[model samples]
Target: MPDSVLYSAELPAFDRATGQLSLAAHHLISAPLSFLDLSPPGSTLLFDQPPAHPYQQPVLVDDQPRRKRRRTALPSADASPADFAALRDKRDRQTTTDRESDEHHAGIALDLRAALEAVQQGWAGRARDEGWVGARDDARVQWRLREAQDERPELDLVGLAAAQERQTVETPVRLEPPRAHLSAAQLFNRLVLNDSSSSSTTVDVGIETSRVEPAPPALAALLFPPRSGFLMSDLSTWSAPSSGIAALGHAKGGWDVVVIDPPWPNASASRSSSYETFDAYDLWNLDLPALLGDKPALVAVWLTNRVKFRRLVKDKLFASWRIKGTAEWWWVKVAADTGEPVWPLDATHRRCYEGLLVGHYIPPGTKNVALPTIPQGKVFLSTPVGHSRKPVILDLLRPYLPSPERAPNVLELFARMTLAGPRAPSIDPLPPPEEGKAGTPPRCGFYLAVGNEAVKFNVLEREGGAVRGWIRQSGLEKAEAAACVPEGQDVERM
Candidate 1:
């Protein structure tokens, strides 16, 4: 019989609920491409075999081994300094692996060449889309150089500075935040009208009035009726009146869940006085209508700390979306060693937590879904902070995800570039056809969990065509034979 224990022993899955660890689910999601270190690991396993395999099985190997995990070998008194250096290098390598594992529960890598090409194309496309011609050619060149690492690994700051210096004209700043006194309503109107002309706006409310309106019809139709009368916008975009007020009016279809992460413009250090920040209006202006335009759903917004943003989200954003209050979930990220802020012997710094405010966009005269009430008893557990930290909505919130998995669509409005690995394909918000050119598609499409965004995947071969032995990627010298998929077997892009 073929070895059932297929693939390498690199992947491991941990079940926090049962305190169990087992082999990761694996099938064809494996690729030889090396992602220069940014992609999330795609689903490393699949449910192809019978469910008879022992899952959640933990090995009791060295259950209580007396050896210390962080032990250093002391040098002999007569040992040379070089001997100590050699031993230290070996120890460092071992220690770093452990740290990396703890940091990345699900590790994934992307092909370096593919990643570089993506970056180059990503910058170039954005520049073209935004009419930023001055930066396109130079940016692509710089990226190529960086990818090759011919001379330097750092981005060519000098070339960029030179290109920027060559620009003869200056961009006009017309829509500065209003200096004169303006009522909240007028300020809101100006913001909505001036979004395209200017990238930044601030609303200074004077004598705020209760001008909240009803949810939009399009939004209501998309979601099943909510328990309350409003929908809250995510924190970053909750500043606009349109963002956090009652829905604009009814929508088309009803929804079960809405996940939003607004991009409140985070200004990096060393920037000028003002920069582009995504206000509530910018985020919700298009999507709110699109989402509520379809279905009424339970909505979840990830938020950072900011008192003004918070109040706007709760009172204004939620009210506008027509999503009523449900419950709040706090996502706490703590290092394994450093328990909490008040704990002693804490080594890590700048550990912060986020909040996931859950609400529902209810429609008028709609009945609420009845279910058993389960208290969130001790739901305040903590985990380590992963990059691009969002609540691990899988365990508690998986039920909200669409089941029967037929082209289940999801959208992340304010997403960064796609990460590789298990959650990769599903995390984006565009569809395969619209993601890229007809032939040159993005690899992120291989991540299959999401469908609403512009996603691109390699067509290893035309559907129903003869199978080959290997596949050829870009930057390669010759065409490779395609992997042979058994007759009628699904050959998903890895």
Candidate 2:
């Protein structure tokens, strides 16, 4: 078993204004702007012609003469009974055609067409309000909008149709209750009342609830793997129940494993885009209690040397999940040419170390002492050529990952795809939510690494701990002393 080590250093103060640098910690960012298109429902629509007026007449082209009818002799008077039946069928067909024409002209068909026309008009009004100048005519524009709406896989046709009806027919659109500030007491009460609750309650806390926080330092390749946010998808295979943060929900029950690298909220940094920030309410409005409602068997959370955030993970996050502190490890990365005297031994000065905060959430009243790893007592170290290079040696921890005592159910949260194992499937990040019909590709998530030492991930270093240390040594304290001490106190002043 790896022993947990606590750091005595205070968390470094950092500036959040500049995101390319890791002011203090590694932050997990969800690119919502890129995922916006994933919100609409359904497959794309194929529209060959635009909507026209209901009464528009079909244009008639120059027509050829109809073929002359064949004439039969007096033998027709002696025709078989089959011939009479054919004549009767022809009469019925003619009568049905007449009835269809009559139905089309009646009030019902006209009413349906009028409703469609009103829907188009309503959509046009909305587009103008939103400043989306799409398409020419009101009807055509609305169709294009609907086509766009259909792109999100999460949006069902029925829900969309209902939304359309409400937008047009219902005079006002007001938000419903559970505007997300439900107290802990309220939540506990609800849980108790519904003791045998099987499913999680979904209250639409609007997009506004998320407050953007500062962006973490940049990585070599930032990836936003969008998966189907299916309520029923089993998440236990990857993330542990307690490892989940406020933005991304946690895994409940015994997750096979939980892996996370959080953007510690240490510095007073702010971000321009909501997606870039770590604590923007968009990411933090998560229901922590609900996420850890069940005990997580295995967990691994990434931490920084930042003192405040480390305390937060220990006191707040862990306590809520009912997980006990187990082992802590440092991921040490040094430059390959670390021995060169021209540069300092620790040439990779910027992001040299990351702390892995590992723990386990046991069931109520269970006395299970976690055993040590086979090779223990020594710290694990690796030389990472890239930024955020996690040691593959950590894979040794895979075996102890928990399975259900009786039946097997697993979930993993905030994960990337790993090579698949035979029995267990790799449930990494889901696909991005679908968007509207425009087919415009979302913006790129990874910024290209530029310059010479860019390969060494140096530009991402923030001027924090070391830089602050240098500033403190620059003699502001000595200058203050000169002003404070009386001139006569220094008798040597003569």
Candidate 3:
């Protein structure tokens, strides 16, 4: 319903240089950087000591003992009763040690669970009382919504019915083609005459095409023009219908970071028909380890507030991918117009905050070298936009990446189009700008593969890109200003 309210005046400022929106009021964006200021915490006491071995101990023998033991061990016919007693004692000690170790580990696991619960509770309490939720005024948001509605009448049931009727009545019938079509000469002559007669019409068409032009360099550079280009395919058939994994493997240095925003199935999302949702179990089929490549990589996932979903992602999903979770970040959504939460903090149907779980991928048989610990429970505040559309967090994530300067080879899975920016312009390719060009924007080069075309459309529109051969139905005017980039940089579709 937030989409129905237009508050263009309060929209966040878009940074052309970064190809990202500036919503810097949130403190979480810079919190991770503070980790550099502190030393790494020592290993936990519970995990520092090794667990007792559950098998028999081996005895070493000296030269004299080896000869004596070999000679004495053969004479078992006259063995003493003390020999059997010694064996029984050893077995009993091993059993007792194993039981004690098991109890110790169980206690440690319980302690960790308690600690996690406490943290979650503390966060919930703070969120409930946060000013963005409880104290901020919504007068400005309401006023803007009212003004928008006044300028454009809100649709009611009657209007909806009338619109449906018009659509049904306006449906065009398919006319059968003539058995014999016009000859090529006749067709060519007619086209030439039409072109000559309407010079003004030709110019108007050209202008319209330019306005809704195919992908522009600026849009392509931001969303799809990474050295390793994007591959678009259905995730359900990621393994069969497409070479999603093969593409990643062929990418430059593989994917250094992968971000996934799954279309989680829920009653509300199902009713809205916004997108096709996948069962949590279905995600297990993805070959995440292969996509992560050989080196250590960062993986971030967007999760709903549901406890079961969160548990599944942290436990099963990450485990399958051979990734260990490092941090949990909260994305707190406020109103775009009033900078207040879209809903009350304690709203039963929807919480104003969603979660992002970040983890590191370490390949099997590799040394588990310690990386800088990620700060947990950080909050990123931003105004809500389209359904499930999250603000860009690449800037915030850059610090955590292995290489910030070279720009980590990034990949987005289960990607939505809105994340890709605007449609790219299909025009002549230009050369890379000189190092010191005044007002030249930086490149946000990243690869993306999406299943849904609708998602793709939304991203292009936001980035000021247009789809070729697609006619504009909405009254919204196309953007005239162009963002140019070097040409011949195209996405590799699978």
Candidate 4:
């Protein structure tokens, strides 16, 4: 029997109620930290049965006492000091020799080179049986490296410094706040119009709205506060809006969870340029705790297999944010056809798995209540979708949420897609009340805000007792057109 255990199983079922997936069902192989002999001791030897023999004669022997050995006396007081020193030196040398000998025998070294070669041979044989293509060099190493760097422009430090200086000088001035007692609609109008003279203008919100660029669809609610719904956006360039802060403050107990997939920088990532990369310092400086609200919530961060990055997250990032890391789950990428690891388990360049680090946010003086423990080392098996596109693990995370009753105020930072789909629609105006009956305002739905200003807004709105969606021109063009419309005209509906 083999000493290590290799587990292979089916993927877990998804939980629709909580929108979480289980990590326990995936195939995972674990070995002992140190090698162990699984067989019974002395079982390797064969013993022949003794030939059937008869009786033996007994003989009487006389009992005699053996002489006792006498103990040596201690060195005499008159003995020379040099003699004592020599004796001590000899003993020390003997002890050192014994230690070295013990170390040599105690160290158990196993040569897995033969085993690895056998595995490779078996893999090759299996590939042949399965009619799969054998491994081959896809590209020349030298050419590949050169081609990756072809588009990278040479840096100019002097020009960059001058540009920074110019930006600092040209930064927009802060706007004053609107007057007190303004209604929500009035406040929204002032913020959207960039009313600089209003007495209630917040510097952060003002700067956010001053630019003609349209914010992400997810950030629409944050820029223009909504009663309720979901929101998703990328934090590549923009800071957290004031309305988002206020909304979180007013939430039942704040957001129930916040999942962040930071664009962690790496050499391979720089070559691909799939998304913008952020330095460790930039990720560390993000205000994650403020997004969680007043109540305790679960924080999950997706991580790569880099030891240094993992250390930064555990020792520095989470520590600074007052979040105690609880468990780590593995996302094992398997071959789509074979349902096996994409690469060998011990591949030198890449591992077959990535890690998800889960932590809990505990404020000071709060009761340190024990949360539902999630099993660590469980495998989340899934086939690769696209470059760095992770499958939604919200189903697996729902069980550990702070509140499981209602949909937890979930937020995904650095999000490229929402649970619904990519590119959420823009803000829709509530329909007018019906005749002879009080028309309650339509329940707000999920919101997704993007960072790019060029994408058109397909805002989902309520109209004529049904939900209707319309695609409007980008906010930059729409705002310009709105300025020329008659004061009483509804330019948004038009």
Q: Which residue ranges in model 2 land beyond 4 Å of their true spot?
A: 1-254, 265-275, 280-296, 336-351, 365-378, 385-394, 399-412, 416-494
lDDT of 4 by residue, 202-224 (tens): 11111133354664222211111
The sequence of per-residue lDDT tens digits that candidate 2 reaches over residues 360-414 is: 6655566755533221111232223222323332233444455422111222232
Better of 1 and 2 by lDDT: 1
Cα lDDT for residue 434, candidate 4:
85
**Candidate 1 vs candidate 3: which has greater lDDT?**
3
- Per-residue lDDT, model 2, residue 195, is 9
Q: TM-score order of candidates, best first?
A: 3, 4, 1, 2
Residue 352 of model 4 has an lDDT of 57
lDDT of 1 by residue, 1-494 (tens): 01111111123445445576654322110111111111211111100111111222234567853533323457789999997998888667765445553242222111212222232343343333422112122211111121232231222212222333222111211223221222322322111211111111222223333463542211000000001111112233323334422122221113334566654444431143211235545444443534445344556777654445555676677777676644454443322222221111111222233456776556545675442222121122232222342322423443343331211222333432122111112234445554565432222111111111101111111223232101112232121222222111233531
- State TM-scores per candidate: 0.33, 0.30, 0.47, 0.44
lDDT value for candidate 3? 0.41
lDDT ranking from best candidate downward = 3, 4, 1, 2
Any runs in candidate 4 off by more than 4 Å, and if so which?
1-246, 368-370, 420-494
Q: Which ten residues in a row have the lowest lDDT in candidate 3?
A: 194-203
What is the lDDT of every predicted structure here?
A: 0.30, 0.28, 0.41, 0.39
Pick the winner on lDDT between candidates 2 and 4.
4
Residue 313 lDDT (model 3): 89
